[model samples]
Target: MGIILMFMLLASVTPFLFLQLKKTVFALVQTILLVGMWLYFFEVVFQAAPAAFSIPWIMFYASLFVAEVGWVMFIIRLIKTSSTVQESFQ
Candidate 1:
């Protein structure tokens, strides 16, 4: 689905973009919180659970959400390590 594709693209590129743009940790935290909240909102929106599609495409999107969480955590760790290394070299 188009939404899944877009999410995949975002999940793949956002961390690198954040690093390149030297975005603040606060921004990343805000993004993660916003996404988690949005997902929770949608789960509530579909309170009855999703309908059974012939091919269950939604599963991929759900998995992508999990992957994105990992990506966010990885980015946070990357930021911490970079900052520590920079401080050490200074």
Candidate 2:
């Protein structure tokens, strides 16, 4: 439970860091963290007792979904922004 909460907190900050940080290494670290969080949540979902309707379980899945969406948006924005920069340079 503590670990899950910790991951939730970290996951919450990851998108902002991924989008705002200018450093490539920082973006890479955040991407790794995002993937790790998804895998950790996947394990929790599979190994936990059957309680799909429970409040905590629901929240966990909800957060996982939000994190995944954020990751996709981050990728799209990164590509769009990079392409615009390249176009401007050209």
Candidate 3:
């Protein structure tokens, strides 16, 4: 659970880094981290935690979902900006 949370925190920051770097590689890595962390939480933490932890679990999942959506939007914007820059250079 601690490891999952740590990774989640790390994953949250990566999208901002991706936006600043504007590299496809960073975007790819961010995508992988986002998906992987969620899978880890669902597969590992969800299964291990007892019923008493339900509320915290829900909160964590909701936060992660929100972060994921934000990152996806940022990635889309980054791609659009990159394309615009490329078109201008041409």
Tens digits of lDDT, candidate 3, 1-90: 586577488667766666665666666655665664565467654576434346545545555665566567677887999999999999
lDDT of 3: 0.63
Query: Each candidate's TM vs. the true structure?
Result: 0.42, 0.51, 0.49
Number of the top-ranking candidate, with TM-score as the measure: 2
Give the runs in model 1 whose Cα sits over 4 Å from its true position.
1-3, 9-58
Give the whole-model CA lDDT for all candidates, comma-separated. 0.55, 0.63, 0.63
User: What C-alpha lDDT does candidate 2 achieve relative to the native structure?
Assistant: 0.63
Which tens-of-lDDT digit does each residue in 1-90 have in candidate 2?
Answer: 786677577667655755564545655555565655555567676876535665545555655565555566677888999999999999
Q: List the residue pairs that clash in candidate 2.
A: none
Q: How are the candidates ranked when ordered by lDDT, highest leading? A: 3, 2, 1
lDDT by residue (tens digit), candidate 1, 1-90? 467457655654554555554656634653564454445435545775445442233443444564576567667878999999999999
Lowest-scoring 10 consecutive residues by lDDT in candidate 3? 50-59
